[model samples]
Target: MTNPVPKTAMTMREIRHQLGHPVPPPGVPDAEVLPVRFVVSSVPEGHNARHAYTINVHYRGEGMYSVGHGLAYADGDGAWSYEPSRSGEDDEHDADGLTWIAAHRFELTTALRLARRLAPTLTVRGRSVADVLADGSPTAEGTQR
Candidate 1:
């Protein structure tokens, strides 16, 4: 069996690049971008400690964005789009004008439910929720209390 990709923390800049979001040039107001914090932890289940995936999703925003999670497509020229779809057809899950801000808001139902469990515990030092969330991991920063 193929080994699962090891869990490595990724920065917003890196994740954004992978998700087809715009990466501003140096000194170009990059702070305005919203970020998505995701982790897919492996939990041992059943006998012999086999691993099961536990996905975590966290983000901070004004709650006015759209996220599409589905199949992704690319043409011969390399341009591509991704949207939620259970059907297997080109243009079946197509979307347009989605921005980086909106992408962070997108969460699968299960992901959202899991996130809510952890969300209450994420605030730190009276800072902006977005800033705390953007710091990237729960253990990365937190208050002693």
Candidate 2:
């Protein structure tokens, strides 16, 4: 039977449910998008006289991620701060400090792609992020510097 409601009329949650995506528990407001919680820092290692910066990837309920507003770097004065994206609302934060919304609440693959573009040397337990993703275990704790 065809669905009576148009696809556009259905909420993302409803659409996801119909498509067999995981259904969030009752009363979870705006559970459609997942945001990353932990912060991922990008350190420039094995580079020639390179500066360092940080990028926080908040991991939402699923394998979804919300990349930070902009790269966090030390200014000329050497104070660390977020550059803040030129695009508004690129970095929305919730009460728990997670980015509320991003240009894309990227899944694992997409998130890794963005990470690789920015932090190619990002590694967990000395393994490349790609390798980690290949093994179906991207949840390894970010090694503390």
TM-score of each: 0.20, 0.28
In candidate 2, what residue range of length 10 has the lowest lDDT sum? 44-53
lDDT of 1 by residue, 38-97 (tens): 543322222121111223454545433222122222222222245444343444333322
lDDT of 2: 0.47
Q: Write the per-residue lDDT of candidate 2 for residues 1-145, one digit (tens) a residue.
A: 8878755578888888999988888787664454445444443342221223335555754566655424443222223345343444444433223332333467766665565455544443476544433554312243322
Cα deviation at 137, candidate 2, in Å, is 34
Candidate 1 — what's its lDDT?
0.40
C-alpha lDDT values of all predictions: 0.40, 0.47
Question: How far out, in Å, is residue 126 in model 1?
Answer: 44
Clash pairs for candidate 2? 35-59, 35-60, 36-58, 36-59, 36-60, 37-58, 37-59, 92-100
lDDT of model 1 at residue 74? 21
Backbone N/Cα/C clashes per model? 0, 8
